[model samples]
Target: MLEKLRKLANILYWAATAVLIALPIAALGYLLAETPNPNRASALFPHIDIIASPTGLAFWSAFSAGALSFLLFIGFLWSLRGLFDFYRKGQILTLHAAGAILRLGKWLIALALVRFMTLPTQTLLLTSNNPDGHRQLAISISDHEVGFLLAAGLLTLIGWAMNEAVRISDENKAFV
Candidate 1:
């Protein structure tokens, strides 16, 4: 039963990771496909304008968000690999592996906090009417995107933690 539970957790974790990676890519692709114009809505955050030309900062920001998300997906894969090793080798209780999983959880939490902090700034930047307002709004929007990415990361981390705890608890029971 413990083995079956672990397998289920692994499946869920991988599936969630795939969805996380795919979402940003899809959003970015859609953004790129849209003809750039000052009046155009943002691909990811619908309220923001596309502006006449994409700034290096905007491009880099998007790239970074996508890249970070991709990296998290890779981390998820690593966690899955560890889980598989535990399942096959009955090594679930290993402290080293559990610690690695916890580290991943911490990363996710950090990502989420980053996102939460910037969301308000992004909202202000995206909605401002004047030139100064627009600039400020742009900054705010970028912050908001970061915040969203972080939130997603946090969710992923939470999921990983839950799985790890479950596995650890089950392993402990076997000893008792």
Candidate 2:
């Protein structure tokens, strides 16, 4: 079981590393493309109708929002990578590993919050190119965000439990 866990951790560490490298490049490519992919645009601004192609101020505003989201994801991945590294090193029960898990949970919450807050701004920006009457500012909180928050909360609780476990183990060792 220990060996299998270590092997899985090594795989996760590399997967996280690969994503850390690929995410930015993919975002860059998406942003620099001559025409935004329709599906991606829809996914980005689900509540708004992008009647006209984003350009100038609208483009930059949407770009900034996307970049911020990408950065948050990168932070989350970095924390995950750190946790995986600790597991790979057979240090899963250490305070440092628990801290890394806490950090990952925190990062997830931050990401969810930012995404929640930015949805309206991103929609407004993406639709700013539409005719005056067609432009929109839409606010939405989807199940995805709610589920993300729940997961983050659960992970944070687990981290706290792990910390307590470590403390108890140390106390027991001292007593012995």
Judging by TM-score against the true structure, name the best candidate.
2
lDDT of 2 by residue, 1-176 (tens): 98999999999999999999998888778667745554356555556678787766676677677678879989999999999999999998988998888888889888888888787887777887778898888787779889999999988888888888998998999999
What would the TM-scores of all predictions be? 0.48, 0.82
lDDT top scorer: 2
Looking at model 1, report the run of 10 residues with the lowest lDDT sum.
130-139
Total residue pair clashes for candidate 1: 10
- Give candidate 1 misplaced runs (Cα > 4 Å): 6-41, 49-54, 117-130, 137-176
User: Candidate 1 lDDT, tens digit per residue, 1-176?
Assistant: 87786777667656756776776788678668874443442554565453433444554454455456556655655665555555445555565556556665665565555444444444443444335435433334456556666665665675567667877787888989
Each candidate's root-mean-square deviation in Å?
Answer: 7.2, 3.4
* Candidate 1 residue 36 C-alpha distance from true site, Å: 8.7
Cα lDDT for residue 15, candidate 2: 98
What is the Cα root-mean-square deviation between model 1 and the actual structure?
Answer: 7.2
Q: Which pairs clash (backbone N, Cα, C closer than 3 Å) in model 1?
A: 111-150, 112-150, 115-147, 121-140, 122-140, 122-141, 125-136, 125-137, 125-138, 126-137
